[model samples]
Target chain A: MPKDSALPSRNGAASPGKEPRTARGRETLRRLLDAAAAEFGERGFHEASISGITRRAGTALGSFYTYFDSKDSIFSALVTHMSQSVAAAAAAAVAPGSTGVRREREALAGFLAFARQHKELYRIIDEAEFADPDAYRAHYMGTAKRIAARFDESVAAGTMSPGDNEVRAWAAMGMNVFLGLRFGVWGEEREPDDVAAEAERLLRDGLGPRG
Target chain B: MPKDSALPSRNGAASPGKEPRTARGRETLRRLLDAAAAEFGERGFHEASISGITRRAGTALGSFYTYFDSKDSIFSALVTHMSQSVAAAAAAAVAPGSTGVRREREALAGFLAFARQHKELYRIIDEAEFADPDAYRAHYMGTAKRIAARFDESVAAGTMSPGDNEVRAWAAMGMNVFLGLRFGVWGEEREPDDVAAEAERLLRDGLGPRG
Candidate 1:
């Protein structure tokens, strides 16, 4: 996927003044998003303030308004940005020609590593369920769709059995999510590669003993 | 397992006035929980009120105080109660002699059915992650433990391949949860049995094509 394509589509017509025009404007937008992640991740949506985000970013209050109209719009964008980051992480981890279950294992390992580093990812995305339900639904739906697409490729390559790839994709996404929750955010006692390998075993051969 | 043993243990010494001793008191408690479900489910934790719950229960203020001391306590108790309810639903669905993946499939089917009937379950439980962090973690941890125990049973009965059952159990629980979220809460175009069967196929076998 192209870098920008991974992120959620914004409505330029809805917010006319929000789009960044110059390279400096894009940098300012990035800074604001990082700062918003800290503010919202620490104080949550209700308590977090635009001033706090601006202060954390070391940007003027006007800079915040330059990119985001309100706290809600910024939050919605942050979620989309984070969702795209997760996809990008997984994409980076999978090498070219990585096939079937191996591809899934790599994606899960990448997610695990990302979650460990960005612990705030959980709180922010989870809060989106209540703060911005559309983003929350879109994040998971988009993720599952991506995984389903992989299943299609693997099936064409004769690397995986052609079953209900849609269901299988959702199941795989769920497995990665909870595994990340347990081993990634909660504790890093287990290695990401080890966790991913176990998951791959389950994905490839399931619970039954192999001959 | 004994009926009461399936539920989480409460510390009586922690809160003395909260427990009801009489049958009428128990009935009142049940009414309060059901009312709470509606109140919290519709309005969320912050906006939900004691009087709203009481009005929904058709009980007096005095009656509300008979079991729960405050809104937080009731929400905590409600989470535990709902967790128990989920376990009970699964227990009831599994047959006496069901083993291995069959047992898990039945449990998933039962959970799906319960989720469909009690749509508020997702909102209330997911809200607990923020509202009551301890209860939220406990719910998933306790659930994962039960699933791991089932894995132990299956292994001893020669019904399943023995690997890292702990990780396998969590993976399985994650699959069931997301499947429930998608098919159960988001849309019910698919049947519960069909979902469970597909899940069973994934669990018993895997993504690899059958020989």
Candidate 2:
């Protein structure tokens, strides 16, 4: 008997509300994604092959096709997974349920922690995005917009000024970007937490805004 | 027949230390370097091929080898060439001959102009240095030190303040990096010069240590 795919099979008996039935099916999907991430991280998206992924996952070539149509699908899935993880970490950092300055510190610390843990994935995502213009726009601008919304909220309160929240948001995040570019992406030997703390200070006071 | 190459021949005469004996030879070398910049900009160091470079220069592969030993040599040459250009721009931005906020504005504008004009080479050099950790540390660190010195001078004169010139310098340049990333790198639709001006406003005032 053929195994059912958890990805909403092209032909299905269940409605949209129905769920994936088999635990084995879910486990297989997870293994495939994990293996794909490893392979993509090791040998960039272009250089990685289907056989390499299947071999790493210990699954048959035919089995790989059952869940996804192509390698691009795997990449799309990886981006979605990583984006959600980052978003969740960000959400956990700040909330109406918490204090202000403490939440800011938590947010910065949480991001650095995540970056430290997923160095390969971080590199892969950067490489993949810049290698194609369309992907770069979609991924980066989408994140910028989401982050800008929070920056706008800060502006709504007296925390930040109302002069182009987008630019300031980019500026704030840009510090983190260069930090990642140097430390995370380049594999430079420096304390990320230290860099994050320094960046936090820069964001809080700017270059010399309050002196 | 070996014909002629880019570098000066051993048989050629020179006055102490000088360039090519023949004007043609000097132009050939300049053309080769320019071609290498464009080619490397188009395809990053690893992805670009030497044969393609020679073709772009309208010269023979032997001509390339004559000036440089191999692809690695060409890469090194390209890096040195771009480094000098960026350094010159940085120097022009903060000329040894001048001092004050006006000079700072000019310096920033000069650097932004260079980046806008030479987008591809910028990416190539950036990625190249990133791939090689120690490639440009002295250069970047030295530039940072110079800017910090300027900030320190302003503070000592009571034009600025005593709060961490190092942080201020980084934040200033950090604005340039982010503006470049947003306006140029990500293919965002905005005028670079205008964005540079706005960024300058942010650096000089936006985060100006307001009370």
Candidate 3:
């Protein structure tokens, strides 16, 4: 699958209505998204407001209306943006010619780094489960599909045993998400590379088929 | 470790104030928790109300006050209650002489069944991340510790390889959690055993340490 295909849509500006026509408009939309992350991360959905987002973006209130019609729409858009950001970070980390295990490890390491920098990534995406149920489901489903695609490539390359890629993909995604929450968002007690290395081992060689 | 040690505390009634004194009182508290699960599950934290919980529970408003001081306290208690419920379910599913991998598979199966039965589990626990951060952290930490303890047993028994149990435990927990969400909460298209089997395979023998 192409890299951009993994990322969710960017036509988040008011969905059916406003789709940022100019390059400057896209920049403004980007600023609004960054501000939304901060606002939602701090205040959460119920307490979060459009004015709060615009204020953080340093844009006029009119600029906010120019894009999003309401707080819910922008929050939904923000969830998609953050989801894409996660995929983009992982995609950027993995180089060509890496093995399946190596790619999985790199994806995790990139995610950890991203989580550490954007500590709010967990809070925002998690809140989407309640704030925007469809967006939340789409975020996880999209991620699992990407992981499954990687598994397919690995299996095709004869590096990974051909089995149920869907199960493995979900399992891999879960492991990464929790590890990120524990080591990345919770604290930096363990280095990201170290944590990823240990996980890589587990992925490459499980506990045992031995007695 | 003793089984009870695996289970977290249940002093959830009224943190600083009262504890249920009699069997009837405990039953009432349980009823309140079940009702809170339904109310919070359907309406979420912001929309859920005291009266709604009481109404669903079929108990007097005074009964709610008997155990919990406010909506926040009940919600906190509910999160703790759900955490314990999960632990109890997993513990019940694990047989005494099962191998580490077997026990882990059983745990996942148990959790999947629990999630299917209590579809609100994801919502309640996910919501706690925002509503009650401490309880949310406690839930995961307690679960990881339990899994780590199981790892210790497995290593001692010579059934599994010796490695970073903490990392492995978290990875295992994450895999089970996501699998539960996908198979349990999302759909009934897959059977719990088949899902657990695939996960068990991943846990026992990873993608490939060979070719």
Candidate 4:
């Protein structure tokens, strides 16, 4: 049977796979998230209408309800998507054996590259962060924890100074947040590489092992 | 004959003093600007209604127009009020003979303290920066010139190293924008002192002389 065969995939019980069902569901979700992101970014979290999102995605308005209970629910989903994507790329920026400076550069570079690609996503996150503080705090604290672990590793290896890890963590988080605001969020015309380099330079001088 | 007169006996020029203005005009302008700042800050620049502002200030709708032509005019007037107040404080913070690190520290401290006292006004500035990028850029660049001048003076006196004054000026600007968004606009529960200290630490490290 051809791999493209729909019937075998439909009845593909050998692997118990749900191909078509999963494909359409995932595609619907992808479209909704993308559309919601654009809508929320432009109209703001509170102002953007669900009907507008559905229209933008060319999906039935009812379909939006199937995926998201409310606009805030869609916002939560976007945060999850952004968090997961940041986590995946974060590991590359801080592999087990990298030095503190090397990891700092990679992390800054990773974030700038990610931010450049998802400029609108960053906008959504920023607007969400402003419109509702507690909700965004949850999103922020979770992401900060992931980056904080990298800071911890640097301290453990003596590649970075031993300071209050929590304070240092927040500072590190601020650095990334500010970097994104400068280049991506604020619509400033700066090259991502230049920003990453500047961030890396600052981190090395500021947080590297204190002699 | 009375000191309380609208035209207080002034150091009159040889020519009759210019058409006398009452303190009432100044008082009306103050109330109008404050009311607009509060309304715009809370409801957002785009969503705020002019009627709401006049009502809040205990003035008739017509009175609002008497003080300002339109919402855009009110915004222009408020922006001028805000930029001048904050810029003067920042300029004082980085005045000549001030240590570079200390100057930056005081500036951030002054800003956060100002925000802590007038949360509404700060939010108005923050929201406007996002909603109206052109106005924000003009405001930001205006401040950046001051910072650059301070940095240039430091270099001339051999108090600070010469580098990209323009780039460093921008970094200074970005630092304030990010911190304002995080601490001021978003209203995180952290103390103003703590936020200011953390920000100052970052700037001192980020913009110090290149080794």
Candidate 5:
């Protein structure tokens, strides 16, 4: 979950024998993925081209093939890469020993910040529904599972109520995603802290009128 | 909000001068939209063809032209049509005099059922992000506004706590959307009632431990 770990290698994302071995190679891989994010995020999957990604990365076509076999391969890798980056961002945001709703709030705030910085994240993941179905499903399924685990931990620590953690996790994830889209990606009129505060209040206290 | 009102006419969906006047014309327009839904849902906007929609609709190519100028027009119309259908479904689900969390629960349940029945709903709307950005923004913006209005009503009725209704609306919508995708479209392991029950619990009283 380290910030540096957000960058995926062959083991994490790249296809066979395409992994970057050195720090310089890793930098080049990061550049290509960032460029792919721009290319795919701007032009979408179909209209996006390998040459476009390379041009954006300022790398030669040979450098592109050194990392990815095709546009599809890099796209698939980029999705995975972004997913990891999201996880890293959230992990870095949460304070150690934080539990329950407080933990979720920090995570959400982190996500909003990430979304604002990487406005293309939503577009790429959404496009994956058509361009790469497995990656799309894997991203959500994986994130939901991690969230459910957090719920279990909170419950065991007596910091949170116990219920259907899986359902709650999905619900929580959905809230964060949409909040990111509206407040983070679409517009940044509201501060991340303000948005996360409202969300945290809802997560901690629900909509029922207080006594 | 009536179920029958889900169907869109020229004023509701079609381009200028394309509104169906005759009952049969209305029926043909309905068929074309339904067919467009399937065509776009399965093949996607880029790959979907007017002929494919007509073929699925069992209408002539000329019939397609009668109501729509081209595939783009129909896709835009279909987005509007589906948005209306979702609104109608939610409206029909809430019982008279319902308020607060209970009303939101019913709306989510209604949406879950609708998603189950129309598995293609998510695909078409998600595709609108790329195929039709205006329609996509309008759809979410409009839905969020409606949800916020419901929150205002609930607060006035003293059944729900006062907060940022806009934020709450977007969060509620995100929850319902993901729930639909997971339980309604992706799988049917859980009944709508059961899923809605859990979501209701979360919305009514969040993850905080009981006193």
Candidate 6:
């Protein structure tokens, strides 16, 4: 999986007019976001402090203000950053020419691995529901839209059966999210590939009885 | 669906030694929980206050202390109560002879209806992750266990194909959760049965290309 870009300028993660311009500045922004993830993940939004985030980043308090005006700004940015990171990870995992179930399998596998490494991902995103509802909604809505597009592509390619791609996308996204929660964050007994494979089978054949 | 019992004695929702004995006492306890749900659901854990809960319940402040030790205690009990309510809703929705995908469909449909009526259910339960971690874990773990058991029963009865029931259970639960979030809580544009039928089709046939 590709590393989450430290400079997600294209995604507008940084506050307007405060976007990092130089390599050094981008690195500083990245560190702050990473630190924000840790602070918020550990202490949650209400308890997390700007000082705590800057301390975790090992950057000066002024640097925190350089990129973000306040804790809420950084948190909203962090949610967007994480959402982009998840998308990048899944996209990078899909081999060129892969389609249909195979494409989704690789995506799920990639997400499982990402979730394992970033256990705080779930906590932070889940917290956004209360702290930053818009960002939370954007994350899921954007993800489901991407998944729906994949379904549309696969159907057009004659690789998968067609139905309500929108509903299917939501269902598939839900499946991946919970699988990651159970296998990736909660426990690591199951391999990502293994979990994805079983889930892929379910997606491909479902639970209908076989002859 | 059956009303969430005001006195969930079997589930041990009330703080120890505070379980309401008389019918009137049970009704008050029930009111307190419903009120707690609204308070926590609307204001969230951090912002929610004990006074707010009692005001919503229309009960005296002393009555709140009689059943619950503090706001935390009532929040914990509310999580369990909500979890039980969700279970009761799903169980009551299932027909006696239903099995396999049909049974799961009914369960999802039931939950969607319950969620729509109680939009705050998601907010309260999700907040439990931060406010009451044990209850959070208990809710998902318990729900997944029940779902896995249903899969096991269906497989044993030859109504469905056998696979990893535990993983399948989590996947199905995730699917139901997101669907409920989208259709139940966020919008009422889609009918519960209509959404369930689409999801049921996916569960029954999957995304495989049909001849």
DockQ of the candidate models in sequence: 0.74, 0.23, 0.71, 0.13, 0.88, 0.86
lDDT of 1 at B139: 93
* RMSD (CA, Å), each prediction: 3.0, 6.9, 3.3, 8.2, 2.5, 3.1
lDDT of 3 by residue, B1-211 (tens): 3333332334445545676666576678778888999999999998999999999999999888888889998999889888989999998888879977888999889999999999999999999998999999999999999999998889888888888999999999999999999999998898899999999888888897454
Steric overlap count per candidate: 0, 5, 1, 0, 0, 0
Local error of candidate 3 at residue B12 (angstroms): 4.5
**In terms of docking quality, how is candidate 2 classified?**
incorrect
Reference-based TM-score of each model:
0.94, 0.75, 0.94, 0.75, 0.96, 0.96
Question: Per-model i-RMS in Å?
Answer: 1.1, 4.0, 1.4, 6.0, 0.6, 0.6
Better of 1 and 4 by lDDT: 1
- Highest lDDT, which number? 5
Alpha carbon lDDT at A189, candidate 4: 80
Query: Chain B TM per candidate, please?
Result: 0.93, 0.74, 0.92, 0.77, 0.95, 0.95
Worst 10 residues of 6 chain A by lDDT: A1-10
Worst 10 residues of 4 chain A by lDDT: A9-18
Best by DockQ: 5
lDDT per residue for candidate 1 within A121-181, as digits (tens), equals 9889998988999999999999999999999999999999988888888899999999999
Model 5 lDDT at residue B10 = 35
Please state the error at residue B167 of candidate 5 in Å.
Answer: 0.7
Give the lowest summed-lDDT range of ten residues in model 3 chain A.
Answer: A1-10
List model 5 lDDT by residue over B1-211, tens digit each. 4345545543466666888776677778888888998999889999999999999999889988888898999999999999989989998999998999999999999999999999999999999999899999999999999999999999999999999999999999999999999999999998889899999999999889889
Candidate 4 share of real interface contacts: 0.08
True-structure Cα RMSD, model 2: 6.9
Candidate 2: clashing pairs of residues: A209-B208, A209-B209, A209-B210, A210-B209, B93-B107
Cα distance off (Å), candidate 2, residue B22:
6.5
- Model 4 residue runs over 4 Å out of place are A1-23, A42-47, A83-96, A99-101, A129-131, A164-171, A185-190, A206-211, B1-22, B94-96, B165-167, B177-201, B205-211
Flag the better candidate by lDDT, 2 or 4. 4
Q: Please report how far candidate 2 places residue B145 from its true position, in Å.
A: 5.7
lDDT of 3 by residue, A68-115 (tens): 888998998889888988999998888878868889999899999999
| Candidate 1, superposed: residue stretches over 4 Å from native | A1-16, B1-15
Residue range B20-54, candidate 4, lDDT tens digits: 24556545656767787788877877778889888
lDDT of 2 by residue, B71-170 (tens): 6656655666666676578676665645534455666667766777788755665655444435455445555677788777766665543555554565
